[model samples]
Target: MGRQSILIVEDEVIIAMELRETLEHLGYMVVGSELRGEDAVRSAGKLRPDVVLMDIHLKGEIDGIEASDRIARSYDIPVIYMTAHSDQETLSRAIRTQPYGYIIKPFNERDLYSNIEMALHKHRVKSRMDGSPEMVDSAINMIAGAMVITDPQGHIERLNLEAEQLTGYQLSDVEGAPFFTAFGVSVPGRDLLIEKLLVSSEYGAGSMISFPSTIQIRMKSGGDLLAHLSTALIQEKESLQIQNIACLIEPCAPDTEGRAGGYQGAAALVQAIPDPFACVTEDGGVLLYNDQFSSLCERLGDGISGVALPINRVLPESFIGSLAFFHEILVDNQVVTREKMVKYSTGSIVYTIRYLPVGGDTGGSSRCVALHIRDVTAETLAMHHCERAQGESQNTDAAVEGIGDLCTALKEKVLAMSTAYEQGLAFHDTAHERLAEVNRILGDIDLRLIEIEKNRWV
Candidate 1:
């Protein structure tokens, strides 16, 4: 495939040229470059680039924000804003354009690449969910949870894309199959059956039903996934008779709290995550957490069997800085992340914790925040090792040059013994200095690890 194309729109010639060079260096083809919003809009409509980098301030009658809005309304193109403007009025106007991302001026290459990649991914996902569907198939696919609709007799009628993906069976393959055959659900250490749950009495023609506990669903491929299942009886409006039963299954982790309602709806989904994660109320009460979280708590000597404990008390002192970020979530209503190197007797471990607001709204009205903790020690250590190797390679090149100089001195006939001895001493000193530098790096790493351990306990 050809390189992804980009269009640059900036009133400033220098910034536009520099941005084009950066994009080309990053392997993106710069298809069009324009200084005015009108030209940009015209070029975008004609060239149809993969993405556009637009500066909020432009030279013509319409600004970059207005141009982006026009392009989006006309061609569904994604536009990323680049600007130095930080005033509220400017920001308010830029946001209304719904740009893919906003990058502050003087941003690094990494920031630009990350924003473009994310914007492209989001655009692709949105495109996938916008295709035509028959009946309520469109609505079904839009749901985040897997759903299957069955006839009143409990025969499979329709299943959404998520359900098909989860069960490893397409809707066509399971069209006439009984709900049990298609979804093979079972409770661990219990004799519960999918048929038993579908019986009319449990979810009668009149009422809906919710699974009492977390159940393990066996996919057609023979793999098991944990989920929370709920059912609703669809009724015909005119006859008031049951039409079909809709089974909604969402990923969830098992909970000891046994709390019911909307909280459980997405609880198992959080638990299914491999990372040590927890959802806590704004006031610090634990709402839901995965088994990895419980295991981490045990390792830290924090009792986490209950539903209500301040997060500050559950994690080790290594998390004190993370706790402050959690507090900041309520203030900025934005995701806060922290990475810390931890010292253990065996070696150092690096942990990164992120506090993400539960809901999409950035308003402070969000009542809960989700905490995700991951051990990035291996990657962090690998990066350090790579840097150290590069430094050592440079030192080796310098030492090779010194050796070449010593050889040249020996090859020249009139070289003095004293001078040769001095060169040898210099070489010896250089080697010693390099060794010391390495030791210093190691010492610094160790000390940082120790400090982390000390702080963790405090």
Candidate 2:
């Protein structure tokens, strides 16, 4: 091998140039560079490089996944995917292409170099296998999920990178160990289940079984991971005997909340929120939640032991009644809001419930919903006070208007009295009685005006 050659396929010009320089510095020959998936496929066939570094999202009718598929089928070249997206859907699609390695973007030079060498080595090993069952080892390493392969006696033969990370145990430490002991599988009838699976495999090749219940994997770091267990028996074609037992372990819940130490950073972020926050699955299962959420559940008289329980089991009945709203948010992928008042023996508390859809395409089904509960009792009470004050202000304005009208009527009466006095002077004897009556009426009017003014202020 004179020098290993690599091809770069990326949409970003700057990133492509930087990757090329890095590869050159790492002593690998840069065969060619392409921006579009179509061009990358063409170049891969022509250049026939040792490894093709392909980006998942490229600028063309075909994405890097399709291009890699075409290259693998046409040229049998190993392609190592370079991507920034780590979503389940994207990973599933890329894994289907059977790439030699998958490296996330913004990686250091050591990561790039190591992945490149590993891809080359795995590709060479696969080629040397020449259609042997051991070729399955390379395929297993490429999978995105945790996997473990055991011998016919159920002793661990090999485990994948994801399995090592999930269990916090290396292959050197767990090789030849019993599967259950190595994984710390906690099931009531686990021994019987394994015996049945082994006995059933004697009947024929390709015997497989899926564990129905959830499995709790005890990690090396003294933590437990809740996962779903699936196993398939691999038999020799000629011997028709059980050769190996392949076990695929998947999280019992969604990635947002599953795995013991998988989402520590996200968990910290959730814990930082002052309000009660939780990520609830579509089926009302609690994934990630903060301590505030736990306290809220306790306050509601539903104390939960751990985060693995269903949200309905611990939340208030009012929240359970909002199942329709939760379904709507998951279906429509929209934010919804409602208010609920929980009355305890002591007092009542008001909460503004917000449901926001998370991790799904627009107009598509949501993976889960984030539940944020805000204490808005004080805000609600302040709003009520402001509304009452406005009502009182309106009433005061109406009273002042009435007082102004009364004053105008009093002035008119005074003007009429003046005219009567003038008439009394004209007809001295005739107007004398009228003047006396006017004087009494004027005194009554003066007393009534004073009373009205005093009442208006009060």
Instruction: Output the number of the lDDT-best candidate.
Output: 2
Candidate 2 Cα outliers beyond 4 Å, as residue runs: 1-261, 320-324, 360-364, 421-458
Clashing pairs in 2: none
RMSD of 2: 20.8
Error of 2 at 208 (Å): 50
- Tell me the tens digit of each residue's lDDT in model 1 across 254-306: 44455524466456666667789888776777778878999878776566876
Per-model CA lDDT versus the true structure: 0.67, 0.71
Compute the lDDT for candidate 1.
0.67
Compare the candidates by TM-score and give the number of the best one: 1
TM-scores for all candidates?
0.40, 0.38
Regions of candidate 1 where Cα sits further than 4 Å from its true position: 1-261, 317-325, 360-364, 414-458
Model 1 worst lDDT window (10 residues): 188-197
